[model samples]
Target: MSSSSLQLPVIQNWSCHNCGGCCREHLIEITEEEKRRIDKQGWTAADGIATERPIIQKIGKGRYRLSHQNDGACVFLDDSGLCRIHAKFGEPAKPLACRVYPYAYHPTGEKSLAVSLRFSCPSVVQNLGSAVTDQRIELQKLGNQIVAGKKRDHSAPLIHRNSVHGPQQVNWPDFHRFLKAFDVAFADTSVDFVVRLMRVLSWLELVEQSQFQTIKGDKLNEFLELVTNASVKAQPDNDLPLHRPGRLAKVMFRLLTAQHARHDTEADVRSGLSMRLNLLSAALKYTTGFGTVPVLHGSQSAATAFEDSANTSPEQHRARFAELEGEFNCRTAGIDELFTRYFRVKIQGIHFCGPANFNTTLVEGFHGLALMYPIVLWLARLRAVRNNRSTVSLVDVQTALATADHNFAYSPALGLKSALQRVSLLAKMKQLTSLIGWYSR
Candidate 1:
């Protein structure tokens, strides 16, 4: 099927500014075909390519990835922050994955595709450059390549699956109905951003418990309205009832946050056992939630990208977890608009659930996504405190979102059974909203 029917996000704008962070931070796995093409390119010492190792390395049995240079960048990355492959050959000659950075395409219907941006890129997080809708032609071509051989018609991802319901499936039209409801709920600007999320969470519990087989078309819309209105009635205004996350919740969250804050670049991998040991120590500190917050190495990409390049003395390296707990005055129109855009993009692209997330049900997936608010705010608070500022700014939030989202759906550790359980447990203990409200203080 042709990828002519592409749905681009209107609220977001992105264009790569050649920060080269993605090239350094990500290990690009190549297909056998791509590896063979690179081998045939006849690279040598004269081309500035490393001669010590083959351009491709075997990661596992028959699994291969591009090699990194001594400075921990893709072998194709040049000194001027450009891809050697693109300069030598063409953009088409590069690996498909290389061409698809910052944009994620997923099947929204049999013939249509939805594009979601990865905020790991500073350009994307800042919403800088041209509007995404204007790039439909290029994105459509990429979408065609992505879904070239894949099935055109795919079954909709399950709505809510569990021991009680076994597995629940809905038609694509009805599935989109639920998505529309989500979009509308999030689009409501009458309430505070966090309150809007809390309202959705309040009703999503009903979605988890209720059967959806009979909820179709107008019936589904009515059901959604009923539940959403009920949620608003429960909590009318932004007078959020804040409660501290329980000790267990805090420990689990800190560990998870620590994972998000890490940088698993090829450089870190090449450091070998010593790097692993340092990570182990940091993990221990996060688990205890005492003393100083460990200086997670990869967490500073945002600071590096957004902050003045000449600021040598960064204090985030010395912040304590307790220091992040103090109020940073997180609520503001600008901040809410940033989150609104972030959440809408995810929802509209259906990027929070199904194959895009960790194969979680709708409720579970949204809960996991909601957890990002606190995590991002907490990291933003850390960034604020590091700079000797008592309040968080949009830049801090942007940096935190970029850093935390690097692992959001891409990290293998986050998809594990234990990680999934942490989200569920937080919701069960009624700590999810608590964390959101408390951290957004």
Candidate 2:
């Protein structure tokens, strides 16, 4: 494996559908070289980019990035959801980051770079575009430019944090073994994806309890196989027990979901007392645990649902939730396949953990990844309620997923120590499983 040869998720496929969501949603930071090149190209109002505010603004004393228009679109982004640079000077003239909107590249091994796609893109959420594997040449070329002068050495990922055997760290070979086992278990189509997640949690529990200093090479593979079989026997197929989260746990989950579903793309604003007060007010509602779910960007359906439910009567919200108790868990080929490809892409691209996350250990990271299921389902249920439907649709899931994923790994609030601690605490209290079961309905 080498950085020059991109490692992509075989199970996932993506292509830009020119929706322009990325341009609208992200602040594009450019490099010194990129800034210089753009300066040389000489963009102006004639190019249709904003000139009132400098097209490029200094982010720091020396760092700069493209500025956004008053309406919040990137200056380089045209009205048609196209890049002005691409339309004018060609794709190569655009910044590297612009060229790689949904794709994230991470150094996986000494000489390898693993590829992952962001679910924030609507097309990506819908599994639109070409197969990821088929884009090897273009991705490799992109990879080359990304790592042109980068070094080959990379740090090994953490397997478990503060386990009974102490923190577990392994070389690339052992790390890859764990990833392979995870990929296989997660991709199993025989059972629901939620059940597969529960089983992985069971398997990781075993791994954490063992003395993994000697668990290497073929022994690790054997250990994974044994644990997988044991977990299968214990959980069985479609045999999950219904467990409701405690009231306190529900409050905690509501708060966590509020944080996860938050979309912070506001124009830069100075700190003020009013902003603090508004945050405090929102916090109060999040802690209440029985009100309308907090509104979020990219979550129009959910917000509309909550708004409609909230105004009608308190019973409306409760009745909607009651409706979910029976129908939420049902699965179909289309809905099931989206989650299948989603988990596989995360596992295959190594995007759910390591440096890509908030430096979480593999076990902790998996816990966060598993939570996405319930979070998406909760939001999807809200969408169903909005549409006056009892069952969740594929579009409901996609919209819900895109909304939650908009913040998942990218939100600063989620990367905080307190947020990470909450995830760990939920697992210990058995609330994670309860939430999973309840949401699975």
Candidate 3:
């Protein structure tokens, strides 16, 4: 594949600001080749790498990752919040994971790869730096490395899969039709973003039930339009109906939210039994939905990275879980635009589902993506109340997004059967929309 065939999200801009958040937050696993190369780099304690631990730690049989310092920063990350390896050995000398911090490449066509940004990076969430389209040369280089030795022929994920119907696969062209429909649906600025999400969810139900065996090209586009129009007729405007999620649904949603909110940095891992116990306790509190919300550790880095002024210590104002349920007026133009860009990037880059996600069918993965709106808003609400405010500022949403998304598709727990079931159950019980409405205030 040539760099000319690479697809980039024009709506997004990103340049590394050297916040060092990714270095602190992520455990970078290296390929066997990368491991041998790093070893050859000959990092030592005299080079300011941690002396107590080996620069690369064997995490499993024949598997290795860059070790972390006592404070949880990557072994190569220096006091200046830059990669030691990159400084000594140039950019290409760094591991592939190190070089590809926020960019996720999904195989879109036989010769093309679509690019998506991981919102966990503060710069990505804030839409900073040069436009992604402008970074074509650099991204293409990385894309080349990613596809260097890989098979060129890749199959598109099933459009709709279930136990009853098995799998509904589509050709790349037809698959792209669905992506176009999704982009169009979200691109409509006339509707509230939440309402747009609701409409999509309404139509995806139709998509799941209908087979795409004969539907291709124009016919598939026509079918999408009919369902999308029906969804508009059903929703029409922002006069969205509200229904509070049932008790069981709320409990499940909170647990899911807790998973996104939880931070398991290497420092936490090094804490061993106590860290596990604390997580267990936090999970229990989330399950019960009572008392003060257990303070999660990850959001502060996001707040710091974005320079959020309203960011007071969450510990000082530990909020009751009940407080987050209140109205916070989340539907602003700023927020809508932000979410639109986020969703469009995901849709265009084929990041929301398919192989980029956890091998979920299109409808199933979309439902999971839709749930992020509520989860983000809900977390934003928590930040607002904790800071002694009734309304959420755009920064609050930004910080919250950067926080929760750190685990979005990357977390092992989120890919589990139970986590996926939570999404299905909420959508089935009609609680997903309610949760969106309730949290959006």
Candidate 4:
């Protein structure tokens, strides 16, 4: 099937600036076909390709990937921050994985696909360049290629199947009805973003209390409207409650935020006893949440002072981190717009729940998504503190966002059952709402 018929996000702008960051960050695996094709390229020193090692390394039995230079960049990356393969051969000559980065394709249905942008790409995060709609031709071709010959017999994704909560089993059609209502609420600019989220959370609680088996088709729409109205009455306009997260929840959140911020680039070979000890020490620091900020590796970060805070006096850590709290306001209309676009795109693309998120219920997936607000805010604060500023610039927020989204739904650490449960627990304890209100201030 042609990918033109596939679902695409209506609100997004992205164009690669050729930062060469991906080439240095990701370990690209190639299929056997890609291997043979690359071999046929017959790269040599004469072609400006490195020959110190085999261009392709065997990662596992019959699994192969492009090798890296001593400087930890893809072997095809030239000194000018360009691909030697593309320069020598062409874009088609590159491996499939290499060609399909920053943009991900997911099978939303038997015959439908959804395109999701990775904020890990600075360009995507900044919403730079052209509208994604303008690139439909290229994206369509790419999506079809990605799912070539794959079966199109997918069952619709579930809403709350077998969950340890109320109204667990919901039909996909009814669940999608809930999605549309939530998306509308999120897109509503009448309330603050946090307030809109809280309102949705309000109605969602009622939806869970009611039996959804009796709700389908137009009944589900009416059910949603009823709950939404009741929630509006309950929450009222612009009235959101706030409280501090519990110590335990805060500790767990800090650890998760650390995992979100940290990255393992191609250059990162942190293994062996040293790596274990480093992680242990980092975990200890994250658990306490009292020291200076942890270093988010591989971001080429400009926030160095915070990273080396331990070397400073205890008084300095206390003073600097405290300064990060009150007085260093980071929230701005532009920042809110960035986050709104991000959430809307994820929702519109159907990339926030179900199979797109480890089979998490809509509420659970949104709990994780809501956590991004405070996480980004915290990282932005850290960035400002490190630069000896009391304000967060757009650059600070953009970098922090890229850092946080790197792990949002992609990190194995965040995907474990325990991690998923932690997010759910935060929502259960109302810490999710509290964190949003606290950090937004």
Highest-scoring model, lDDT: 3
Pairs that clash in candidate 3: none
Comparison by TM-score, 1 against 2, better one = 1
RMSD (CA, Å), each prediction: 2.0, 3.7, 1.8, 3.7
Output the lDDT of residue 18, model 1.
84
Kindly give the stretch of ten consecutive residues in candidate 4 with the minimal lDDT sum. Answer: 301-310
Write the residue-wise lDDT of candidate 4 on 1-441 in tens digits. Answer: 555356667778988787787787778999988999989888888877778888999989889988888767888988878998888788978888878788877665556677888777788877888999888889888887888866653655555433445536555466568768977888887767777777877776676556666678899898888888887788777756668667887877787787887766555652456655766787887787666554546353212212333223344333243455563554567776788788887776766776777767776787788888888887777766666667777777777887777677877788899889888888778777777777776
- Estimated TM-score for each candidate: 0.95, 0.91, 0.96, 0.89
Off by over 4 Å in 1: 1-4, 151-153, 299-303, 308-317
lDDT of 2: 0.77
Ten residues in sequence with the least summed lDDT for candidate 3: 307-316
After TM-score superposition, the amount by which residue 178's alpha carbon in candidate 4 deviates from its true location, in angstroms, is: 2.6
Residue 208 shift from truth in candidate 3, angstroms: 1.0
State the lDDT of candidate 1 residue by residue for 1-441, as single tens digits.
555478778799988888878888888898888989988888888988887778899999878999998878888888887888888999899999989988998778788888998887888888899999999889989989899877654777788876697788888888888778878887899888999999888998888888887888889889988998899999899898888888998998898888777767777888999998998898899999999877776543565588622124653346778899888999988889889989988888878888898788777888889999999999888778778789999988888889888999889899999999998889888889889989989
Model 2: per-residue lDDT, tens digit, 309-407?
322344443333344445654466777788888888888888888888888888888889888888888878876775667888787788778778777
lDDT of 3 by residue, 1-441 (tens): 444378888789999988988888899999899999988888878899888878888889888998889988898889988889989999899899878879999998788899999888889988999999999999999999898877654788888876676699998899988998899999999989999998888898889888888887899989988999999999899898888888998998999998888778899889999998988999999999999888777654585696654334535577889988878889999999889988999888888787777988888889888889988888888888878888998888988888888888778899999999899889888889888878877
Better of 1 and 4 by TM-score: 1
lDDT measured at residue 45 in model 2 versus the true structure, 0 to 100: 75
Best of the candidates, TM-score:
3
On TM-score, the stronger of 2 and 3 is 3
- Count clashes in each candidate, considering only residues at least 3 apart in sequence or on different chains: 0, 0, 0, 0
